[model samples]
Target: MTTLLNVTLTPDQRDLLEVIAAPWLARGEWPLWANVQHHFDMRGEDADAIFHSLPRVGTQTPFGAGYGFTLPMRAPVDGKDRVRLTVAASLVVPKVRPVGEQFVQALQHMIHLYTSRPMHFDQVPTIILRSEELEEALPDLPVWFFDVLPDLLSNEPTIITGGVHTSRRAWEREVTRSVLQYRRVQSVEGYIEKTCEIVVAAAAQYGPAIAVAATVAAEPERSPYIDAGLLAELETAAATNRWKVHKLIALCQGLNDAYIAENPYACAAMIRSILDHIPPVFGHTDFKHVAAQHVFSMKRNDKTHAQRLAAFKDIADDVMHRPIGHTTPRISMDDLPEPIRLNAILNEVVIVMPKSAPPTT
Candidate 1:
């Protein structure tokens, strides 16, 4: 999923952006360095330094001007080490403005090239100007890093070529001819505008999905008893391999899922599994011994909870091993053990687990 990093500019930065964007706002032309110097009343050298210092968007090498800002981000790719990405966008325009289809294709081509290359260039949706009417609308230029996930464009092939040819030289010549044909039919301004529109629409459509995925990622598994934070702590402890709590974690998650689905039988079975699994953490082969002998280190209420948890095993066994009779058996949410009882036991396990070793530099 892609992440949107909102960029907030200082007052001075805002003023500087206005100076850079003035020419485009007035006449749809790229601003000159001289215009910035005149607006700021600075000398040529000083203006040049300031202009270059700013995080610019669009082609700057040949002194082309476009709206938006450059934001640098460190993000992980395909489970590998994090790489630095330089993200940029063009100026936003109203939706009513006509943008050609060819422009969208061209922009997508550029996106594919930049992202696949060693020098990562990430592009996001353009700033959208929200207004009832174009004549009365004010430009809403917000800067942000819109992370485009690799999977979003993974299906698009890097190279497009003509039909199979007998020789490599023939294929290369055919591809060159196609490229020249495409260039002859494309429009520069229309391509830029359409690219911005497509990006804006994509962001709008996928924003909610990305947010939900991010929330799920932040908390791998959650239940009433095991929240995201507690689960994280348990994971950290388990990583050391000293606690041997991986099965305990899985059981806890199973219990949570069963409880949520209102399957009292499954919930009871999961609780029994958890009871049988965590005794080793307390230096006992059986839960009954742990419950009887391990309460001295715990607080009064926690000790009571632990004892109650031990008693719950009988109820869970009855639910799991009971035989079918003439009368039908029924179970409900009330038949399950209290969430706090499990929470107390898990908390104690975390307290006793060894801390993971620190990473070496």
Candidate 2:
């Protein structure tokens, strides 16, 4: 399974990237080649030589428009999905590697090089693995990390594989520290090195679990728990709403998790939440107006989209908008209707954004 992630940065981090990327950006280099020879300090490069030396799908450099570049490591695009890295204003990495463990290893490598502080998060600053794609890939995400942290950091004075370890405490500390540093301008000591240590440690400790999660995520039994079709729809929605990656990620995570857990009430709650969230992103307040205006570009009728959303809203209202004193009974799995229609509605919102085109001064 290929995963695309957009790393949201703090203003200071953005400034740092601007400074590092200034010379190239000034030269009209949108999708600059990743300087393979010197990965960390990318000043000038011999593009041809770097491309030849680096690990990739082929000799051909990835064709794209961006200010950053792909990492120089060899990519695994066979059997496993390929892991492609594009570093720019946003450190966008699409895991295309064939093997899930390989992808996690690549993720660890790029993540280490990217930052010590947990810059990649949802809305929060902690090193929260905030991608629905990731959740699908790693169902027991937090547990998996804790399980794998010890062996990865085995060289340290205190460490254990498949057992409780201090690395868990260390990992938590790094997240908290990163959150503070991200929110504030203050710098912490050994932030980058410590981050690398923590990440690598976790990766090593949970190597087996990571591989299993990746495999399960990549190839799940035919069940509503893992919907490949819905995954595709969500991915399309994600790419369209790239600018609002954080919000999209949060929403996607909520929707996917609810479905996987088979909780109709939670799914309904997500549907309503998505309905409320869509308006502001598209520069509209009334969802009915949005539907009447034919906001989605997927060639569906406004009336149809409007009605489906209305139905979704009604279904969600039981859990989402019940009165404070009203005792609403919990919805049972057997009583729950799968939210395929709501998923389509949310995806349609992504499709129609560019077409709607909010007014400019």
Candidate 3:
């Protein structure tokens, strides 16, 4: 017996699917029927519903009003029944290729449409709650920040005017209308949450695809650990080179954020920036010559410099070098916990810089 997996769809998703499904669907036949079974071994039993509901090719209807379709589609798994897949129409089409890329494209387009629609007052709170949940659930996932959160936040209209406008009524009707319509609050706590849930739900449907996207899109997170001692040393180091203090401070901030986000590449880049600046500050001028000397040594007074310098150089090299078309070598978060230690060591190197030369006449 063939297994059947059920896929769910939101009302809006079902409607949008109907529009895209028109080309592949025919009144007398489903063009995609053989393709889906051949490729995915899946079948949509209700193909007629889609074709029967489509308006003529050239006709137009109010956006989202005329199309209709059913969802909870079925697919087989492991030659026996398994979990239901909540697929959209985008996922339904046969020609959609290369392992779910087409599905994401379709989903993103629908997201554009969903967010563009005017939201009701009652739905705002739910969206905001959902947004917070998604943020908390996927703190390091860039998709939540870049795609989902922005969509939710932008969905709520800040202004109340110009939509389906109506004039104030005459005395009999005006006096009795609800005063609530005139009152509006600035809270967006709800709108964002609901939009977050929607995006997350879609991500869950296309888990592998979204996960890959998240990895590509993610940035470094902020580190929780701050070193007072290191910070003080950096401040003092910056005193002589006050003009360059901003760059140092920015590096520290970037490092902290990267460490927390577990972004190894970003963390390494921050280290490399400080390393590249070191030789120039003290007039060594040649990075290739002095890079190893400073990185390999601890100040004579700092006993742990040998171990720390060795460790820091090992990590720095992994992140800084790429032979060709390859990823950075480092991956683990073990070294990220104490970036301040490395920063402090770099500050020591900076302290030796000769003050700026007197201006030449």
Off by over 4 Å in 3: 1-229, 236-243, 286-330, 335-341, 347-361
Model 2 stretches with alpha carbons more than 4 Å out: 1-242, 295-305, 323-330, 333-338, 356-361
Q: Compose the digit string of candidate 1's lDDT tens values, residues 49-73.
A: 2333333222222112222232211
lDDT of each: 0.45, 0.39, 0.36
Report how far residue 6 has shifted in candidate 2, in Å.
Answer: 45
**Candidates 1 and 2, the one with greater lDDT:** 1
By lDDT, rank the candidates, best first: 1, 2, 3
| Candidate with maximal lDDT | 1
TM, every model: 0.37, 0.32, 0.29
Which prediction has the highest TM-score against the true structure? 1
Clashing pairs in 1: 103-191
- Name the TM-score of candidate 3: 0.29
How well does candidate 1 score on lDDT at residue 162? 28
Residue 21, model 1: lDDT of 45
Q: Residues 43-94, candidate 3, lDDT per residue (tens digit)?
A: 4333223322221111011111111122222111111211111122223434
Q: For candidate 2, write residues 1-361 as lDDT tens digits.
A: 1112222333433333344344332332322323222332354432232332222111122221111223322111111222222221123122211122332332443244236554555675534332333434556444443333332333221111122333433321122222232222112112222323333344445331111112212432112322334445555655654334456557767776876677777766766676776774456786665666644543432345456676656667777667667664767654443333454555555555545544454
